[model samples]
Target: MTSTVSSDLRERAEAVLATLAGPGARLREDQWTAIHALVAERRRALVVQRTGWGKSAVYFVATALLRADGAGPTVIVSPLLALMRNQIDAAARAGIHAATVNSANTGDWERTYAAVASGEVDVLLVSPERLNNPDFRDRVLPQLTATAGMLVVDEAHCVSDWGHDFRPDYRRLRTLISELPAGIPVLATTATANDRVVVDVTEQLGLASGEPLVLRGSLDRESLRLSVVRLATPAQRLGWLADHLDALPGAGIIYTLTIAAAEEVADFLRERGHPVASYTGKTDPQERLAAEADLLDNRVKALVATSALGMGFDKPDLGFVVHLGAPASPVAYYQQIGRAGRAVERAEVVLLPGREDRDIWAYFASLAFPPEPLVRQTLAVLGDDAMSTAAVETRVDLSRTRLEMLLKVLDSDGAVRRVKGGWVATGEEWVYDRERHQRIAEARRAEQQAMLDYIDTTGCRMQFLRRQLDDPASERCGRCDTCTTPAWSTDVDQDAAAAAQERINRPGVEVAPRKQWPSGMAELGVGASGRIPATELAEPGRVIGRLSDIGWGTRLRELVDGDDAPVPGDVLDACVRVLAGWGWEQRPVGVVGIGSRTRPHQLDHLARRIAEIGRLPLLGTLTPAGPRPEAHANSPQRLAALWSAFEPPAFPVPNAPVLLVDDVIDSGWTATVAARLLRRAGASAVLPFALAQRG
Candidate 1:
């Protein structure tokens, strides 16, 4: 009964899909509809479906149909290297030649470009950052624009400011879309877009084609069983994981909010005889690949990870997802947990909500859009000539990461242009969108509140998450712990609790010293720059523990971030143990205290106790010469403020190693300056020791 044209289109599409799913495989009705809209109507579309809905298949199938109809190759702007890898592999299943150009494959770009020009590539994948790459934008982008048949924006929710994982680089896609020729099919797809995100992305990417195909489906998943274990302390959480991780259904992910937490948890679990790996932004690229493969093959229990492992990781039967600490928002939580329960009958999802979650959220919130004055200062620093990021950092007070992010935003807004060597002004008048930025910030706060509400809710957990995404059809999921019998244990055994507490109570964190001076020190009136002289550098230092470590972290945070107090007896005892275990090349001959303004009692207690216990002479303390260094500054600015701020000890210097002590080591620059002074004053070596380090 199918019309001839429609029947022929389906025939061709089914043939192409057969390669991916094998013989007798078929596309869902929605997938077929999306492909039809792109291939037959040549119209733009926004497909907001859940993860594991085969969104990639739509673009791959559309590309096959379009290419056979003599259209130019398709271009896909994907967000992650893992996503691009999966896409290329998927494309090959359908017999389409796929190539990618991203930060990882820079060495093969020339060859890939030649292949694209020679019509040997059917689909090309690229990261959003590459859209603004000077060479790619100047040399190859124009050619692709003129000949491109279709454009695919994967993880399309990132295009909207309302998205939980909003990225500044994704904003550059606006310029890319503006340059594409008319009637070229554009498909923007994501599994995480909420109502606001969908509308925002629709306006940006599909509105030009007049109300392009908008296909949104339900966000609820039937296969996920959600629950939360309200642990009151870090030890209890670690204890519970150690006792119950092996009982989880299959290889899955354990998400943490910070890199330190990820590494800490991974180490703890491994020591408990669970095979696991830590995956975070700090993990090397090749190691990340290996970890992903191990997880895919179920070679390990889980990959303890931060959000770096989120999105586009295709493990169809991933059996579980456990969060050590709650993410700041329910939307982000949902996106992460969505990786599980995709192709399985049921998957376990657990949240071990901790007291430290909100503190972490506030820390990130403090880094929102800078004030108007800073924005103007940044703009004023740019002109016709390209200035390298390092040069810009010399003038701006922002950190290296913040500066790079600001430049990307400016480039997306047309206020600056990235060229060879660096960035230059575009002569376009830029207005600070304070109102919009404020709204986005407020939205973030609301989402964070929603996360708290989700944890406290007595209703269906999956339904609560779906409602946050504005899913109109969100209904009480019958499989959650709140709705059904619990599947995961909530108890922590005595031995497990003791073991976790024991490990955390043991503290010895090596504090790595700053070996090189920051650039542009002259601008800050500090003459020193480049590498610090080895003779003046402090030997690798030691801290009792990091403020982010498991056991001592919370207490250290209270001592440093709160009002001053004398060092606790137990903490001092732990410090003694740290000294006992410190494998120093040369023992200390004397002790010197770096004068403290806020925590004098604590600082002096630590230094005096170390000196008395070690039976060493207490050299004179270095007194403050000027004002306290500014807080929350770049390396150069921090160095500028600290340089010469500490007066050299007035007492005669002994030409031997001395233990330099401080209450808290936040930037490490203070210690560097202190060490350089001690060495210049004729000391043989300086070894820095601190109560805690602020990450």
Candidate 2:
């Protein structure tokens, strides 16, 4: 299937490469070949291959191709904040004029955006969420269409429902991508993708037919050694981990499912005197970067993390990857383990699946369908016009968190746009509330259906996954439990019932709530009747949460502690642990004891304070509803000092930590809000302190 590339296009791509002709800028031969193929292809094809396949290079080189031919501009839809900066840096190092748009870099975002619209940028990278902005569609999209030489979607697996990283906004990108001029070549590239993802991308975004470029490279990297161990007990897992740390220790990643697990594993390894770092969604960006840098620099030996930590990480020499918890899908499992053995020599992927993995997957699948009221409220908010997420919350009686997620789904279907103040109906037609509800229910059913199928699969687990993805090359991978179980389980039963028995033995049968309460509240010296007084607790302005096993909840019996407190303890313990371990001594308010009736003047004062601060008051109806003193509770001195030092911008105090003061720590809303406000205000740290806890 030979075809001719226009001389103009041919010369342009070559010219762009010439610009990077310096001694340090030599492109790999494979990179050059990939770029050449892309320059010639007229239709969008899937670039599916393993890691280190020069995928990023393929796309970046394409940008140079378009710019050299004066195609206008290039916009790269990136998935991570860090990658935006890293990619821009890489482009700039090659002398490409690149810029990134993200909340973190909001200082110069407007100017940077202007440059892109004005066709001054060779590359403009953006997160999918950023594209949801009406201003982007109105001001940027049109301008980009006129000037954009090409559209490059990095980490395109994000678009696939079957992909490990399934983001709603990434799916919405199909519409955006399809909207581009018919002839403008689109490039969808990913480090990992099976057959299902390839078909979905083509059908949804209108890509090449009859199988896009397979580019199936060898997965058998000789440098990597694969090993799996059956760990049915925590003692065995811990002992094995300790042994690994003691011997053959090198830069590695210990993958876990939850933030708490990551913390526990990192602490466990560190206590055994191993160099370790932890990464998770909860870890702030700066901390994540620092941890990553430590691993890359060989300063820290390992990173204990969730699946979120691996995306866009290009550390090639990582020696081993140990999944402390089993992955939910084969794709995730493969990707996580694939992080190791990137070099030509020996590395290892050690899978230690305990019982908790299946439970975790089931729990996540359950979350696919939310409560009915939540679904109804979400659809009602998505009415006709595109409204900013915040605006939708003001109109709908739903939590901002739930509203954000719902709108994310609607937005994914191109049914809405989040503009300045509210959500605007955008797609050709909006999903009718009832119909949308039905669709979601169906989706949830399917999710649950798929889960059950995976749980009861008869073939090799790896083979089952391959079939799920509709891959013809599905084979019994020598690894995984099902493939090797017969060889190892000679004494076991041969019947399907027996195989089911083996699967059931994998643990996680006893499902428990994710939270663990305080372990030593009674030991803290606060007796049943000796908690902090209610009057003092009601002094307001305090951030509160639950302390189930702590004296704090007992104290809340007197204070206005309600049913929905944040958790068992204040974040103070975590903070204190960090500070004290670093040699700082501080006394923490262990629990709140009592409550007090609010005075009329106090109510008036609260209303006035809410007005003054331009924040919502703690509103209630006949429920002792008035702004608690906590509403305006903040260290006046600290606030003033911070405001002066940081000098936050006028618009909603970018990243400024807001105070979430409450009378009692029934639920953690107050502290959570305060912390979220701080994050939104551009504050790097949101330390929530409280006088008492209730949950």
Candidate 3:
């Protein structure tokens, strides 16, 4: 690293930046330091800088400089599709050819692969998941690693289990790092890693020799004026947003904890005459892109979104970020609000802390890796043959998300490998680190408590966040709400509150009938396979509300938790309203109750009430032919447990559509089995209805 060489690399980096960020663009001191380490010294570096700190520029410029010196393409492992898209567009501006391989562009993969193979791509952006893709890992990844001039891990905090947003897919990068040629520069960048996360990520990216260069900047954002507005209820939060969304500066994002909440908020705001769109994990990719475009172009007031819209969305001039409910971790909150005020002088950051945040956090925490016995059972089942995730689910008791997460952890740990069709046990001995898992779980609980403290803290909000991130330089900022008089109004209009209440209170989500039987049912002695016959299938059903929903969720939880208490008057009335508004093709002519082992009286009362309201006959109950099985079994097991448990009514069933009443719908297997029996016993059609649907 001579003076002449250093000067030349600096000049080249500046030129790349000028192309990327206009003619007057210049790299900051830390950015230059990172570029110098990567290009001039060929050293590994971890940069923990704030958002909009030109992190992309450091890597893009290094890519340009390295490519000019006859090195291979720079390979970047990113965590998000939106980030990859943004990076590709940014690279093109800097005169660097960038292409991405992600789930959204499966058709273009071959063409992109060909371009990369021919050396037409200067920078290749790929998702961490792609690193574990059977085809990519077996083919492209090897070439990319062997010839890569520089490796960049964007959103590197995700590589650390301690990070707020940890994904097991990111752990696969360790294998990639180990396979890379010696002295090829590596850069890991993130805006959210705290001290623990930074330490963990650095260890994951450690070189065989000397320490990696770690660059950390201040975490404070002067442009963001943070505040918390405690809303007593979900409806009040929605009302506040509807009343004040237009008053916020320019266009922004309104984040919700759940997809249902996001949709509910967006719908409520739209009904109140705001031009808002919903963005969540369930939103179509094309629609998500459109919503992003709308927000960027200021076409919409805001996008009511979940964490699906959180990372890698680079809107420099984003005017505000309003959280309908606080995130479980302060680190996550900082990361989200970092999206705002990036290129502006001021931005509003508000949190509407709700009572349900802890409950939501607990639900997510339950998805962590199961005990050692379960893990060993899963591996023993895999044994030698590769099994698809769906096949594994039949033999395992975990939910789909939990099962996938466990498999990914196993794959990253080398105990299992994900191949073309499915995952297979590699017969590699794996030590279950019970202590480590417990520690992580405890850390998560601590983070949740920190979030609660954040909402209640009267000190400067920015300082509180900085301290949470382990920044020692955290000082009271005069820009936040506590440091100054409240800058925003807290008043919500009565009409808006009433409107929001009306929308949320209106329940009845369509319960889609299961089309296909669960795989591997034969192992359980069940002969069911392929698509369920149309005649035997239950018609599209209705539930008063999802257990995760805002309005009826609390009431439904109480009813389900109570000791077989009769349905409350208000809840019963709500069910009647759901029925009145249900737009089914045919009205149910009779009501049949599913004999509940736990809440038989409640189920009977619901059936009687529905019969009275619809003027339908009260068909006799379906009695259990055998003992009740375990309640929390997986779909196949549940179905097997209930297969012949329900006996057809003793009397003749009406030859008309029947309303099958139940207290709660957990797996929907109970409803499916009961409906099939009813349809077989001379009922024309069975429309399953439940007081609530468990998510």
Candidate 4:
């Protein structure tokens, strides 16, 4: 490109920018440079700007310029639905017609395609996952690839496996970029990418050995006042937030590491009269939309959210971002906190690091790339013919979630293809790179450690995060708690602590019976398939607490990790309270312990205590007939492991409802299988109870 700008092009681009932004808005120099590169030079560009840097403006402005020049429409590969909504709205502001084809809008895809074909849509937004959709790839993508004037990848860090928020599907974009005809400008944008990620993503742009026009800006946000409040306990952190959330700058987000935490925190806050809503991946679509709208319109003080609210959420004047727990990495933390101080003069960014943060991180890490045996087993099970994920689940002893994650990685590597009905091996020679996976694992640990370092650092918090991202211009931001006076209070009072303690300590998680049997169970020497007979199913059950809930979780985790012992005092009290709250229509007349060799004493104590409390008979332990099931084993494998593992208790079970007690219900399979045994032994109903549960 040239340092000299074309007068006419500048005038037209500025006009569109003004429309998309405000009348007083003008393009930043780097924004204009990116637009010039894409529109005038028709070159691939990678823009690594801050979150509120108007990255979308560059693409929307370039889209307008290209369309005005009689070029075909721009195709934007957006990652999130929330972002697509904002992008479509932004495009309309600039008089550009933007339509999206994502999983959320399946019914509108045909119309969207028709609009694109008719030259009515100026920009089309799609998810990276859509690129691999059999129909989208085999039919629609060809037309899009052949005619697209420009390709824009938003949240481009996802293209690199090293990125904090890497999605395997985003790696597939490299193929698209490679297949694009020459001179079709490609622009990739993200707010959080270190130097390594920058190099990886720039390569993904496929510039044919030429570097993409790399534009990286400092990641420091001047409007955010960063601070850390080191709370000693989950109850204290909850207490502090409940007491002080309203005193913050404005309506914003409260981020938690887990869905259960989000729900727990939100419920506690609402009880304290804060208009907070929970937002997680499992939230209903309409409810999520409502929560987003409430946050956007400032109808609620905050939305307790998980990473589901990570990208595409556009609220310019959001006043605060409070992390109930630290994110796993500095880059991810920066991206999440960027939701604040976007269009505000000042915003509060606070982190309340918890003791369980590392454990949560480890849990997520456990879900990473499966070991070589599991990977090879998955591939070996997949033949030329298509096999559904469920069928594969029965054949391989991997959980459904891990299987899907592994399949995506394989699909991205061209080892498997997701056809119409199921997945099929591509018959391609697939090599599992142990070194690469191990390196990524090590990188993840480093990121976690960096996040921990960020918590303990007395230096400028903003500078620490920026340095982690390799921002060259990182400096002491006078806005942070270290550079300036701390903006948030660290004191958590006795009353607030008591409240938070009760809120977290109070626990009840429903253990709904497993309904469906694992497919191909017959192959595993189990006759079960389709739905489990309702007659043999356990009645709805209760757990004293979840091991992932904020307060009781810590206590339960300690108990779960320690050597087998009798139930703790608080745990026994909690179970009693939970049993009282269960309100079962059929009161259990007997208590039976689930067979356990690892924690036999713990199980016996729980069963005996519950029987004593309920004034019921204590049936003998159900002796194990086989080995214990693997806790993390696949569903079918777990079921097979438990099959015939237990017989009826030595004592005759009365034909009344029986209280089946277990130490914990991690998978809920053991409880279900035990309950089935007792029922078949003559119990009318089985109400399974547990000391703790894993969320």
Model 2 residue 499 CA deviation in Å: 35
In candidate 1, residue 522 scores what lDDT?
81
lDDT of 1 by residue, 514-633 (tens): 999887678767799889999899888998888877678888888787767778788888889999999888888999999987777778877888899889888878898887766756
Q: lDDT at 534 for candidate 2?
A: 26
lDDT of 3 at 630: 69
Per-residue error for 335 in candidate 1, Å, reads 0.5
Q: What's the TM for model 4?
A: 0.97
* Worst 10 contiguous positions by lDDT, candidate 2: 507-516
Worst 10 residues of 3 by lDDT: 202-211
Between candidates 2 and 3, name the one with more favorable TM-score.
Answer: 3
Off by over 4 Å in 2: 1-37, 92-94, 117-120, 208-222, 246-249, 369-376, 381-402, 425-666, 669-695
lDDT of 3: 0.88
Root-mean-square deviation of every model: 1.6, 13.9, 1.4, 1.8
Mind giving the per-residue lDDT tens digits that candidate 3 earns over 138-165?
Answer: 9888888898999999999998888988
Each model's total of backbone clashes: 0, 42, 0, 0
TM-scores of all predicted structures = 0.97, 0.64, 0.98, 0.97
Cα deviation of 658, candidate 1, in Å: 2.1
lDDT (C-alpha, whole model) for all candidates: 0.88, 0.55, 0.88, 0.88
- Encode model 4's per-residue lDDT on 299-415: one tens digit a residue: 999999999998889999999999999999998999999999888899999999998899999999988888989899889999888898878888877788888878988997889
How good is model 2 by TM-score? 0.64
